[model samples]
Target chain A: MEKITSLADLKRIKEQVQSKIKLREQSASAEKLVQIRVGMATCGIASGAKETMSFLIEETEHQAIDAVITQTGCMGYCYAEPTVEVTLPGRQPVIFGHVNRERAREIIDRYIIKGELIDGMIPVNFKTIDE
Target chain B: MKTIADHILDIVQNSTRAGANLIEIIVVEDRKRNLYVVEIQDNGAGMSPEVLKQATNPFFTSRKTRKVGLGLSLLKQNAEQAGGGLQLFSAPGKGTTVQATFQFDHLDRPAPGDLAEVFLLAAIGHDKVRFCYRHTTGSGSFSIDTAELAETLGEVSLAVGEVRRAVAELIQNNLEAIGATR
Candidate 1:
């Protein structure tokens, strides 16, 4: 592959990748695909969020589950450093705390694939104004 | 915040958020000159002259989601506290480069923390974005480019556990080989 040297080249590649993602999204209902957000702030990274994120991504893909994994900054849960928020189709988003590689695998097998809630669920305590 | 690697990760996040598709992070340790440098360059939506002027001001921010943008300012503080300084260059359509240097053995300078983890996170989190990381010491240097890795991996995603582990190990091993690991 050619090295991306300039901003123009970078923008061109970004457009191509974005279009591919758009096509993928268009092919499937957004609500049907699982959405996962991993906390990756300084605190989260210090606590092994990167490892948790890698595990989640790999396990989900290995299981042939269609999902979108995104990295987000702190969710203000410093106590729970490696936090993960999972949003199933039409259900409310559920946040998990202290997620390690093992917890990640369990989340995938139970919560994600089987739609069964397991341990480590952090209850939604606050609400936005829209709520 | 606690280590140079932490600051690198924070600064790279700024680049990614600024619409950068390609980011380069370079760490050079010149023992003879007694300087340790961390430079991050990105082809992002570069800032305007006015914005660049205040880029290091903690109170100035372009994001509406937060009132204070302290990443750059804090990095500057960290560099200055360690007997070094920071320089930022940017143009509206060009790109941004942040270079920070510290005294090689400054007592206040924190070690580069968990760099392999930092590299792995950046590569896997922004799989579409190309990241090039270079670590140089007085003796030798090691560099990794994600684009090249992608070509080698064929269809495997870097987010895969095995891939991430391998990449991290590569980074750690190379850094150690060059006597740059902390």
Candidate 2:
């Protein structure tokens, strides 16, 4: 693949990606993009949050999901390291634990895309991964 | 942090939490000089003298949720283990800068994990804040300024799939070009 070396290259990318942005903007929920926060603290990184985060970024890109993925500090759920909090449009944010690459894909497919809760949905004071 | 890339992400989070609107990550590797330097500078809410004094202690933290702040301590450990040291500078309201230096050929130096992935993740989600990365090796140097990238992006978000891919590729290619290790 060719290297992206200059600001002109980014300008070209912006032009190429504009059509897709326009298509989404024309929809009723144009202002709403899925928001994902991956924990990247020591515990999260130790548990492979970097891999989880990179996978989420690639998967969302490949699937063309209108989502913004970002990193956050630990959410006090160190036991469930590599946790991901997903917020869909106006829905309440859902945090999923033990979100390895497999679980991240499942979250995107089942929870974010289909609006169905998966097994890893975390609740307060619960250690599901331990049991 | 397991690798230099991981530590970059972890410490950048600390800057974000401090309400830093501008974060600078710099890495310089010169084998001839035997110097491997990693620095993070932020224009965030700085720490007080008392807090700064104990900042490297694992048990001292500003967050109410936990009693331990291991970010600095761990980085300090990593630096010392690699035949270098960590330096910190901060003021009450100015900002904070964390710099860690290592011997370029030190056996204990952590591997350079994935710099591209780390850079990509750092720039996303914080539209208001700007993250700039400057990486240099003996061969050459490369840099990414979010302010310039934002101008090019216009209203498009950095997290957009194609844009994200492009930015990641840009960082990766630049890193390789500069003779940076993976």
Candidate 3:
């Protein structure tokens, strides 16, 4: 692909990608796709959440995994910042703490791809008031 | 904390949390003036005088999730240590603006870090909020508003993988053209 220099270039690329997205029906409904949420609050940023989030986005896209990667505020896990919450389709969200680039790779390989839970997952022990 | 980009990402998160729909991040690199400035202005729920007084206190945070709010405090310290200062302007219903200045050539100054990445992630994380990033150097300047980009792309979302990468490239290339460091 050519280097994006202006909005016109962006618009042209969007047309191409839109066609690809249409082919992937799984990517159509956001809930059915994988959801990766990275904590991006002050605590998470200080612990390098930006790199982890970038790695997650790049890794997933590179592997062609239909996933939604986003940023969230602190999950009250300031001690174990750079935390990531991954939710598979129709599954409960599981959070992993202290995520670096390497750890994020492991997440894509083990948990996301293979469906095998890994260590270092912050167990969701408490219930919210809504629950 | 470590880099001005990191602080920018963190501070922007605060803006989103404060209910801002439009957040503007401005970075100025002025070697001639010996100044590097990072300013984040938000159209969020603004702060009152009493709350603003304690905003820089490391131990004070408005959220119940944690006791300490080190975002502003850390930025303030980083600015002062680098021979500059931090200022905040806000009114109850007006909004908030955070501006921190540093001596551009100070030995204690932190690197700019990955500014393009910051813009990408900031836009991705807060999809509902529109972010505007303006970077200026002595040579030239570039500014991008997410709303405008979204309009240009029509219905395509910026978070799309290909679009996101393109957006990053757009920012990185523009910053380079303007002679921004890192």
Candidate 2: stretches off by over 4 Å: A20-31, A125-131
RMSD of each: 7.5, 3.5, 2.4
Candidate 2 CAPRI category: medium
lDDT of 2 by residue, B110-158 (tens): 9988887787777874667898999989999999989988899887877
| Estimated TM-score for each candidate | 0.74, 0.90, 0.92
Write the residue-wise lDDT of candidate 1 on B1-182 in tens digits: 78898788878878887789999999999989999999999999999999999999988877654466677898899899999999999998788999999998999888888888887777777777899999999889988888877765545455544445566766777788889849
Q: What is candidate 2's lDDT per residue for A1-80, written digit by digit as tens? A: 45686778878988988876755445436348888888888788889998998899889878878777777887677788
Candidate 2 residue-wise lDDT at B33: 85
lDDT of 3 by residue, A1-131 (tens): 57787888888888888877644443458777898889888999989898899899889878888888888888578999889988898888888998999899999999999999899999873532110
Candidate 1 ranges beyond 4 A from true positions: A1-33, A41-68, A73-83, A89-131
State the lDDT at A55 in candidate 3.
90
Candidate No. with top DockQ: 3
Q: What is the fnat value (0 to 1) for candidate 2?
A: 0.74
Of the candidates numbered 2 and 3, which has the greater lDDT value?
3
Give the best candidate by lDDT. Answer: 3
Candidate 3 Cα errors over 4 Å, as ranges: A1-3, A23-26, A125-131
